[model samples]
Target: MVRASAGRIWSVSSNPCQDQIHYAQLNWDEDGQPLSSVFGDVYFSRVNGLEETRHVFLQHNQLAQRWEALPEKVHFVIAETGFGSGLNFLAAWELWLTTAPRSAQLHFVSVEKFPLDKNDLIRALALWPELEFLSQQLIDAYPCIVGEGFHRLSFMDGRIKLTLIINDAARGFSKLLTTTDPLYSQYSAKVDAWFLDGFAPSKNPQMWSEDLFSCIHQLSNAGTSAATFSAAAIVKKGLKFAGFAIEKVTGFGRKREMLKAIMPNNSQDYFYPQPAYKSASTFPSSWSINTNLDIYPDKHALIIGAGLAGCSSARALAERGWKVTLLERNNAIASEASGNPQGVLYAKLSYKEEAQAEFNLTSLQFAQSFYSSHWANIGKKTGVLQLAHCDSEQVLQTQLQEKFAAADELVQFVSCTKASEIAGVPLSFNAIYFPNAGWINPAKLCEQLVSHPLINVVTGIAAFNIQRTEHGWCINNDRELQAPVVIIANARDAQHFEQTQHLPIKSIRGQVTYLPATIASKEIKTVICSEGYIAPASAGIHCTGATFNLKEESKELRVEDHQTNLENLREPLQELLAEWENSDKHSLDGRVAFRCTLPDYLPAVGPVADEPAMLHSFASLRKNARAFIQDTGKYLPGLYLNIGHGSRGLAYTPLCAEILAAHINNEPQPIARDLVNALNPARFLIRDLIKNKR
Candidate 1:
């Protein structure tokens, strides 16, 4: 057992709240079925696991019928207590592909305390050759289940999403709850169905606790259905105590009985014999959902800006069956900050598990998987090395390594020699190696993202004015384009809109120096970052530098900026710098662009709040910052923003896009509720109100 102060590494038993991840310990039966060594139970029925899943969960839940009846552009969400061998999820995915509407999406959220290792998953899933196609996809995109929290994986071209939570059932479900605070009123998670499949109650009784049932109840709504293979009294009682109407059904195979349940449309009909947990205070008005808004009645979205944010948002929505009009002010997509030849997929993580660090880690992991899925076309997985050039950075890296020791596959603290070997170039200092991080051509990625059939791209068209009409918003351009939903992803120009003008987003000029790769410089195989970064040569030219300047706007490349880049790289890549120094200084080439950033370094995402209205609504905060104002935040209905990614846009955009899309569709969020609040667009306004600055 290896333990650290913050979390444990490879410990058989550990606390989920501490971000420890323990893989399932399994023993193979005679039939090659996986038996959980910890729970003393089989993962599935050995006789016929596929058929059992189809009968116990799929058929019992009426998924095929429900999916068939789903309206166009709508989505169905299924939450599960245990992810086991992923048999149930794969079976559901297979059925959904053949039965669900093409325009509808399927979101499957599952919690697994002990996720299988990649090899174990591959072997277990191989038992059924019929599910090979779907199984291969899952295998290819399986996240490195090394820590707690949600690992969101997109499948079937975004039509199916898996939010795999590696934690205890009760704790995982609690995270899905709208608000964990007793002071904030809770909201149901719009979970259409639940699959209560795990080890038996006798073998794993802790998972069938009342806390788990309460969370299930909180995340469900009237008419939400559930199916389980357990008919134990504890299971029945817990479900009933949490207001589910259950019936004992014939079990699968040797089992004599199973359970199927649903929440009735009327609360009076609920079987809540005892008092269920209730919030003492009203839900925060700022985060409330206004039913009258009806922003998503039509699944059409107009995205302003054709950069990484806009293109990513368009693709995410398009994959969910929404038609998007992508408007670009420049001659082409990615012609602004995203036009660089190669953008390093770098993550500046903190030693502590604060919001910024957590967000960066999650986004970095997501971006790595996202780009890996697109491989050679988008970028190379050449990996990245962040040199600890200074003593402070070395100490920070040491702390970070200790904090994430279990996640060795994601990051590693290496000696100077190891770093040099990994980079295929001589290095003078120790570094943090990101094995999955690399470089991406933002332009190529943006083009591919917007190439979806549902996305309509318009170039050289700027949306200067936006007006909210009776039905939706209208963008003033060559021709007025209207959409029920609009996303502002135009970088620094995001604040130019009347609704988002109050946003404290600023433009910082950055220039990337282009150096012709020599034989010596070409030896550098991975991205190396200190004050700036240099990627492995792409097309015979190494992209580096990226000098940061504040309040300066010059599209032309500056020689001084090029010199600044070289000087920054002098210490870290001294050997390579010597080789490149002989080149003509005046002929050096580079590109200049401006990045949009916020004071907090977090991007502005989610719905655009009506500034004045929110200030007035939460006016009591001015007098007492902690005052509980029970009012929903006033927002410009259907307007959202996905900007302020700063220099880390490549690492931030993918997950942020998924977050915005989830908000629009009312799906289970891909991240924690607290992280959602951290990225909330109204955060600045709330801070100002608290400080009495308004």
Candidate 2:
């Protein structure tokens, strides 16, 4: 086996219509009906297949039996290949979640090359109404990972993780074998049961080859067990060759035979004890449940301001077994600059294949899916349109359209007439219409975010000092509150702490105007962004303005910013307002707040600590990084953060919270692992001091 950890590989271009290729392409005959491969393997060979899965995979895998058998709580790992349509995975997951004991954790590891787009996935899974919610979750988080990387998604807090390896079987299993590269390898997975569900060997030769069987052999333990609908003799021979003693059984559907295999030998001889995942120590617990599990999870996540960053972080942590304590010093959330009645969910694109624009586009899509799935109760799918005012804008849009070459349904070139019609307001220039974009109630969203059961929200609490403790950290307010983890999400107040005093967090104050939606306003159905934004009337309030005044950090409404917004939302709105001849400027209500923004725009997450350690560790970065300890060890111990959401908070928070949780849970991250390290709080310390010769 060519074994040294391989270097980076070039990415295969994905099908423009979907994130990856379509699995159906391999399963269907020319008529697109269920046809076997040349070897005659049906995609789903089980009749009442769903029931058969529950009975065999679930019951035999001893799911209900296992749960009932548990003397103490533990986690179960069920791995699979070819997660086509996710029916089997979802059904199994539903059983685990609903029927399994609350204390039990289920890890469903599956590999998939082709993943369906959301609309189609949602449509396909509609058949299984019982698994609707679970399916929606899988579909929503269906990673758009293009190349070969493990896209780990969290479900049921940190308990269930979908370790979606988005590559061919041979490569994915090879990487899995090396997961314990001798570090942080505790709990490196060995499948308890493998659900083999790839297309027939004849149809997809690469998937069912000897190399694939070799991977299974190298990756699994001697006791590892697997099941498949295929009873083909070649399959039996391959399993036997791979060291798995195979046996034919009653098959599903019209098939009279199926196969199950088990490697009945001691695997512990090859197994190296993994210590990284196993905590070096455990906390003293008053009860058994608390002793074995993270019952006293780190709580008291502080969000100083009720703006996007704080609220979003608070919401994410709160949902995932963390006790979020949001401290807004103010009387209400989003009273600050994020108090806008409506904020546009716009995706910026560049003509020159810009990095920033690409990031924004992906962020926009992730954000939309995040909200649509997580916060659908409060979200509106009005979509956002970026107006192209001039020839330069048009040129950039056209070039970007070609460079992206993604699903055309994502973004479309709308002429003035169509743009005007879609906007529900008249338009003067052509624009790019993002059909999935819309505006959100920032404050309402915050309220929703902090409303989780695990979250204990206290407003009007002014934090004076934050000091670390043996148990956790202390919040110096009325008396003192203890928490294992603390997040300084209080915008400008975050700077008051000694650990973060060097951070470049600043407050930007702004004001927004709220007007009544007229029949003329009905024309502005979608969010329209130029210099400023105008959103469709929500709850009878037509939101406009949002003039950015960097110097004014006060919460008082200013006419200048309003006038600035008026000009920014120009074109049709300008004419409509002037034509109304309504000299009354007070026809709109105004509000203001401070926006805590970082200089470089990226957030300060993970840990906070002395910068000197960071600088010293990464000191050799200016020269050859490999010559020294280039990556700074995580700065703070037991202390981490999730802040600096900025204006992109709506677009960034869901993933940001995910990053924070993954770090704390030691699970795979939602963002690129490199990006996670890049966003580390100690990153700037290393860059400015260690990597900088100047």
Candidate 3:
């Protein structure tokens, strides 16, 4: 949905050459209504409605005294003309989880036409159970599309992002990406608060005409405020002829006057700039774009471990130009199990349709876009749920909810009363939820993924020393250097390199059983999962551990691994731990480490070659390996490895660092190069040089 053409600025009546472009395109009429307009005894809704909208637009748009006087993480962005049944987005997500504050961020935006149906939004959000779990995460992200629509429900990930604009608020505020100036703009950030509630002016008079206040005064910018439950008189003469200053207020809960206005500060010098993003200046701070310029346009790289997968792959390859030195024999950086404090985006969903259900659905959508803005710097969103244990994992969560209907925010399945209202507990099992999943903090996302800018981490410097050199591979992480490429992302201390100790790696030795928080585990705020996994309290305990063992590899620390993580959290919160073993205030805070794996558990990743030149370069198909061939260097040339992402390193380490930087930037590898040579580490010396020539 990325098309628009009213007075074309970016025309496209139709073109589905999509691979990625969904800015949610739209257009609907023929009785699907939504031409919209209204003012003078309020009415609005050319579709959008959540109760003649919160006492006519957020109680006279003062929004709880403009969020108890702003200042912290400042963000407000609310503009609207319609976005039906989102009940003003579940009443501004229950007023930003009850009265903003806590580093604010909202960005609402609206405008829509003919869009509803997911059982007419589950019969109009079954009369809002007081926004019960955000109206069941907007009925599990509405959008079924029988026709016209534009959607973007990011709820609670960037702290509520919304952005629907289905079409026509005078062509979606003239294709926003604003720079401000349309009509003495400035409600705050060029167009802050202004729902204006459309639907009247005589059943939609081209939405209060005069070209809708000349497209909101050419996309405004000048101390704006424009409100309207409607105080008639040609809608205050089209908002005082689109420059704003009108005021009338007093209509909410009992209508008796309401117009509120103010656009003063009109030193209108027209401005709107803000969206050029592409700066990480060898990475250090500020980022929103330059996401390592299309992800590290290689200026140089060679990361290979400083722990936490070489300090998060040397800050995702020196924020994309790879100068990282990390290496490490252990001097600090998450001394393993990524120095846990929290780590549960655990997506193991395959209640039927499998391929590890598209590899745990593209590693939980790149771990929710790599931990979407770090759960407010450490962790929170508190929703992972999962539950269901028997009856074949409740019919594999209904065949992974129809094979992840294009990732309906990671996954759904609920009911044990909407999974006890999103895992607040009280379940008869059966759950799935994953509403953008949560529980992060892994040493503050591994020190914010190796705080970038061509990283040089160093640590206990342990490469020891290597050879092969004509211009690459010199080695000596303790001092010497040179490279063509090198990466191991150490874990199970990469089998002390005798050419990676015949890697078919195995280590397990885990242990987690923390439990402090009470009052029924502090009302469980999501992230529960069955057989193992508990988290939701984080850094204040609650972390219900891991206990794999593989015959123990000890870094010390156990109690039979906290009785195998309280017997795997007694299978799905066993009746919410019926006062968990007669509470003496349950204890045990396990963690042991050693987890690297493989035995077809995938992720060994490319080029660390020359084990009998990949056993005679795949010796006529490992006696049984001819699937397809042509890659004849069988690479060992400059060495590489990302490690068998066993216990799904937070769902496969940033998608195996975008598949080992797209096989070191030859690009295109999103899966398939024979699943990237089935995670190549030279398929066990091409199956022992094709079983000694058969």
Candidate 4:
């Protein structure tokens, strides 16, 4: 670990991606304090960890005072270095809950290279019985695999949000600081307080490197305060050089002294001036405006459609202090595309590392973890087995396993014999088993999402006539409703809006047949998918097929669709198909639904553009594709869209909703830059312009 010089940018170290996490080797000292064998340092004060955390972190930072004085609906952010046993985080959360206004939110961001496993966390948290209530929630929501990425966990009905980045301190802080994604813009890479809780400078010197301090300085606002148990010369010098005014403080228990520091009020000198967004030369144009401008107003949003997209979007925005009004034409939520009894959490992965495949993999993992926390009993963790039906599919599966470097937790290739044993059924072919994949009840998930206190769902009202008013956009019908921001999330019906009519959204009709689970068929444990899929028994029946038809519109259950389902089931459940074929046609039950999709099959998320205005502005892109234009594009101010998820609604909608929330809040996005562009609703127009097809 090299030290960073003042006025010199420190380069981030290479990722420790493949390195196994070094768990803390705990040893009890004579005084009964937990000691780390690797670092040879105490985990906390020998006298008391809880009191030390409150004094060294909370008192020095004045968290309780700051939290009490916070403005309404504001989010107070605290970033910590080493969240060993999360003592600091727990103390802060408890203080915030007691001191802050009910409407204010607390966002605690922590970086940990080596997180304790569930059992370890439980054991360690047991030391603080007073914090048992909060610790239990964290334990329940903790990531099982602890994969490399940001894991966001919300508690207290979304009032408290914890974003745990499991990575090296320097690497995580650097990645976070460099992100231009809108989801993180809310804080501008600044935090209110810092908990420099790594082991003592002598014991774990690597964690207190100058690079780490420099990164911390970069993420701190002018008034950021930090406290640490170490008052070593290097610790003090690094923080002082990085722009914080430091002082030695009285230490807890037997410790001689600790350090406390605060960035000066005028300490903007640490950061370079933010440069403008680099407009893509081939990107579409619209009414010229600043690309970095945020358009959200008054923290209120009106969302059309109450299905998965709408409800998820509503929940995301509501968590961010936005009051959302969700409108559905049907008398109840999820009465359309999201009304399926069981939706499989399928990834639909590809061999090619394209945007779709990458997005699917990440979204699958996020949704699986997210559903386990939010949708608990409504979903099953029975892994999904995707069999290779053709030569091309077999090649793709092989590539996915070998070339793409898929992890066993995410997916693994299995032979016919292995697949049969895993599924508890006689299988025909080899498969890719997604261990994290499962099945969810779409309607139930939607119901849970809209139940948030910040979301006001109004069903049985069709918002047909919409007009841009001086106040905001107003929806007119028997009743008039208005909000500063509006989101179209009604799947295919989004096209009913004049602004969205130009969108190439196609509604594909589909039907899923349900077969009564027999003693033999009930043995089918995992969801088996080839051309079609069959979920494990739910309510004494298994959901199967989903005959896709582009032209069909009628919702009536067709006898032929059931036959098609039976035929599709023969390959996977050979014996069960014979029994089902012999049953009465009327006994065959199923659900008919429409899946909204785009020409390119990606969901239309993010901001909506003024299509005609953009076309007129960037029409020349058709002639000169390489021309660099200053204008990115013009989005209808405060207007956004989250639709066209197709059949992977369960897998895609949650992440898409998060993306929409990020755009609305002008925060950093969770996904990469290119992937964010792929979900842009204006991409179709940009493609048409580049192809000279306007």
Candidate 5:
């Protein structure tokens, strides 16, 4: 595992990163309806589930009316306790499509401990033929692997976003409520409507507890409202105790009564903001630092560098109606590390359940689905076989089996014999076979991302010496370009700017050798990854090697590095290498590139802070680690960052782009709040203060 000593702010887990999802066990009723065996309750009302959903959730929440009244480009958020069958979500989406403005977006966040299997969810959704058009779209994009934490899915050309939290209801909300960053906390807690759609409080009492209701209260604002199918006394007391004015409503189907509630204007109750972890005391959770900052996308944004980070950021912002000017120092986009002929789309996951590992797993899953639908022409879906290079075969296999009990379709532990069969070649070690991992051409992806009409690409201009202005910010190179917002995504070169000079970013030189594919080597069908990787031939040439040399930053390729790459591949593909050598083609040809990396191996994303103001405001943190000073640090109003991706740019860039876009547009975040804190560009600055280093 990649280890770092940042105190308890970042926790490491010895167990694998995967959280086996609890799938719903279903039984078909006589009327061709689905029943949950564990909760002993039907998914929806016995009489007309669709109409019942429209009344209890949509009509009670006033979604159609609220959506119609929203301004253009405004985002409406809806949070729910249960996500059974996804009928409520489809209903909300269909209503929003017809009632809401074209520029407006909908964000739906839901938590459910037991998610249905893909086939079961598809079958259950199929029963509602009226929603066939919407159901098919959801089924096509639904996550195949249902691991825990957050599973984010985007649909309708980035107009609809769904964040599915696969965990307990109360615990998940508690975790979300612990966010300390004011810029992110407001978005995290801003829920407009609540759908209390879990099984009846009688059958599923754990989901409707006082704690859960209190969490809902904490997340709700003065005008927030809720609707539920239960009017049980405990449910009523819980909502009332949590500050919602509750009222009995007409029950659906055979129910005697239902409930509708709203946060009263005179209600005066608030929960104490909890810390994410016991030892995280560097900052108070109640600070509303950036809550007042207006992030409307009315002005233009200037983005530096046209690598994956920059291009994807440009696309995300442009989709939100922001005019974007993408600047690249080189003559073309992706002409550096992202300019590699082909980049692998796999994540180097660890058993350690730290923030880095969690980010990798989520981004890996997101990229696989994203590339297939958006960039299919430039990407391939050939699965990857990651060999066990550090530990014993038995130990690796054991960990894989225990961690991914429900994700057999996503990955499997294969013995050497099975590994060879999958690779279509000879192999020497057991491997973790990733069925969904593959490769993509980064240059093509970069080109496609910046093709929007709202984006203007400026090439061959190296921006330096950026300064905060009265209106926004100014970048001066050969010319001056000013924008309300600026994003630095120029890899390690981002440190050239005075604001980011202290960032812990360094460059590592890497070289990849290309081998002409022989008859035997051409038969290899899958990407084989050991200490180094050997991809199957895409253009009659198999790409392999890639020596990671930190001491050298020279662009020149040395023959020794090529030899090292070949030597690293000898053991895993001895037969293939021997056959190619026998053909008298010993000369090695390749390309060299540099990768930007951080000490902790996580990318620096989110808004940049004014260093001087931060140092003055949080000065007390250096003396006493737990100091609760009144001053929240200052941020550079429009300056942001998206850099330090290391070699996982293909996997990390897409979601980081979406996160940055959401932060800029004041939209609901696609991932959890804790994970966002982990990826914050200013995390190291906070670390330094906590350690009394600055």
Candidate 6:
């Protein structure tokens, strides 16, 4: 196990010097079997890997029988220690489709130190033709595998979701066990099954350590089943130490014995005593608390606001078989910031892997895949080019290029000539090119998201006077509407409600200039960015500009803002600007909207905390900020928030919606615990209390 301190067993560096992912090295034998070059072990049985996986993982965990017995609209979670070639996940998915109810969802979370390259994965899975359909889908949606964090991919119309973590097994699982605030560790979702599939303990002892078993125990509850192909003494001893009841089982092929275990239904029947070090005053002991609020038995939700945040949240919940009531104050949906003609899909990554940089990169990737799969008809995958217009920007671009050297497919530096060739226009400076990045019509995308049968979109009705009721919450508007769950996604207006009044969100006005596409301007094939961005022509017009004004409140277009947009393009696209300025046929027109943002620039997602209750609960921090308080912050039950996306609503909303839905459904989170805490709705309150302002 990797220890950063005396008590902490899983210590991940917040800012590691090297963040590039290292893919698994493999050697193919004459019989077309993959052997791990690092561990000198075969990835699967030489004799039928498919049957081996079905017998060892699926049958042993009783997944097929359990899936058949699952109730409608329920979800089952299965976590794996190592994801070598994704065979186990594919097998589980195949069985789920055949046995599980259509309304049921399957979530698979896997950790891998060294994931297989795309080509290697394809080659390995090709041996089984029966799984070609599902294998192809997995291959197509697979991430670039360049960074060490959670990469969530959805399949089968969001019925099957995968949270792929590219990190060490122990460290990655530890991320799910605890949040940034160690006291909140009890909030993690417990796994229903565990697949301990990796190299043998003799060849790879690190993967079978006590630390990993402890994480497994922490992420499990009564009746959690575990299966593995190893029957070594260390494996048995570790599982027993972690309170699992183990039994020897028949091996798959050439192996003599395997192990199958489950957590006893009663805690008193556990074999080993709880570790003393875990309960020490200096250690984190909140995991012993049972703080999980009951998931609303009825899968129905009411969401306020119909913008990108609201629409995305509705779609996410609807996909999981929930009936959603989407309320919009305006006469139509996407009439505010989401009504933009075009929005760019790209991330501004920093040199280090901090919260802002990491969240942006992760969200951008998820948004690209989401739009491509769901709204491909209205979106364009024409790529984006970020020009290095100044010395500081050039230096930053260079540093980013070096930082992501191993991920050339995600982002790469291109010469001016090469960039021009790619963009189909003349360029003066070098740029960073994101091949998967492009532009999407946010209004159309929102329409597509809310078109689901399970989501009822109600317009022209403003929700106010939200009050807690005996059954759930009620919004007293023109007509009273009540539901067991509620999500506030009205951007800056989210704070208008009494429960969320303490949120410190501000509105900044931004205006986008619409320039009719000229013959010369139509030649621009890709979205180009410097201080401002100009997208390729769509419907004979190019959407550009977006001047950021903090104090402006008027929604009318300003001539000065239009001039500023043109001037902002001078440094990056001087040649194109010169051609456009001389043309009298083009008229300067634009649209103005307000962007809701926070002081830290990160969106507020997940469950909303009760302001008055939290202030009273954590008030002890005012006296001593470092005190180890046992009391967790108080939260308003069944209340959630998905707002403050600012100008990047198109990029941030999809993943934030998934995170919120996961918390609501009581499933595994799609991101790390630290990132989850970063986007917590009560973060500002915690900060104020720490500073003695509350």
How does candidate 5 fare on TM-score?
Answer: 0.91
Poorest 10 consecutive residues of model 3 by lDDT? 284-293
What would the per-residue lDDT of candidate 1 be over residues 260-304, giving only the tens digit for each residue? 999877743343332242323434434433322353777899999
Better of 1 and 3 by TM-score: 1
Q: What overall lDDT, based on C-alpha atoms, would model 3 receive against the true structure?
A: 0.59
Report clashes for each candidate as comma-separated counts. Answer: 4, 9, 35, 10, 0, 0
Q: Which scores better on lDDT, 2 or 5?
A: 5
Off-target runs (Cα >4 Å) in candidate 6 are 1-21, 178-186, 268-280, 283-292, 477-480, 582-587
| Number of backbone clashes in candidate 3 | 35
Q: Give residue 192's lDDT in candidate 4 (0 to 100).
A: 76
- Judged by whole-model lDDT over C-alpha atoms, candidate 2 comes out at 0.61
* 1-694: candidate 6 lDDT, tens digit per residue: 2111111111133456534346777788887778887788989988888999998899999999999999999889999988988999999999999999999899999999878878888988998889999999988988875558889999988889999998888888888864433334336688899999989899999878877887887777789999998999999998887778999999998988999999887733343344542354464312122254567788889999999999999999999999999999999999998888998887787777689987988898888778766546657888999999889889999877656665666787899998999889888889999988788888888899999999999999999768887777889843358888989999988878999989998999999998888788899999999899999999999999789999678987888888888889988778778766665423678899889999999999988887787778777777877655566657878888999898888889999999999888878888887788789888888788779887
Question: What is the number of residue pairs that collide in model 2?
Answer: 9
Arranged by TM-score with the best first, the candidates are 6, 1, 5, 4, 2, 3
The sequence of per-residue lDDT tens digits that candidate 5 reaches over residues 35-139 is: 887777899988999999999999988888888898886778899888877899999888989998887778898888777777778878988898999999888
User: Ten consecutive residues with minimal summed lDDT in candidate 6?
Assistant: 2-11
* Per-residue lDDT of 602 in model 4: 90
lDDT of 2 by residue, 1-694 (tens): 1111112222334445424333332234332323322335544533555776665466544566655654323456667777766777887777776566665556676777654445445655675677787887787677554344455566765456677766666655555542313222222235666777777655666677777776566556666777877777667877776678677777665757778888768533333344532343231210100001132343455555566667777766665556677777777877765667777776565543233443455566556656764446565778777888757777777766544444444577878899888887678888888786678777778777777787767778777777777776777833346676677766666778777877767677767787676667756678887667778888877677676667665666666666676777666456666632354565557777666666666667665655565555555666653342312253555566666666666776666666666555443344443355446665555555534642
- List where candidate 5 sits over 4 angstroms from the true fold: 1-21, 145-147, 178-189, 264-292, 297-299, 389-394, 477-480, 579-587, 629-631
Local accuracy of candidate 3 as per-residue lDDT tens digits, 1-694: 2122121111122335411112222233343322212122222333344454666677666676777776554456677775656677678668766677755556676766434435445545665566678878767655432112234345553456565655556655544422222221221124657777665566567667776676666555466576777788888988777777887866654457879776666535422232222221222111000011122222445565654555655554444345766666678777777666777877575533234444555556656756665678857767788777778777777765544544445566667888888777676777777787677767777777777655766677677546666655667542266666677778666677766777768877776667777777788888777778787675466877777778575676666666666667776677666655555433454566767887767668666765655554455665454323322434555566887666767767776675565455333234422344556676666655546542
Q: Tell me the spans in candidate 3 whose CA falls farther than 4 Å from its real position.
A: 1-78, 84-108, 111-197, 204-234, 237-262, 266-342, 346-556, 564-566, 569-694
Q: What CA RMSD would you report for each candidate?
A: 3.6, 8.3, 23.3, 6.3, 6.1, 4.7
On lDDT, the stronger of 4 and 5 is: 5
Best of the two (2, 6) by TM-score: 6
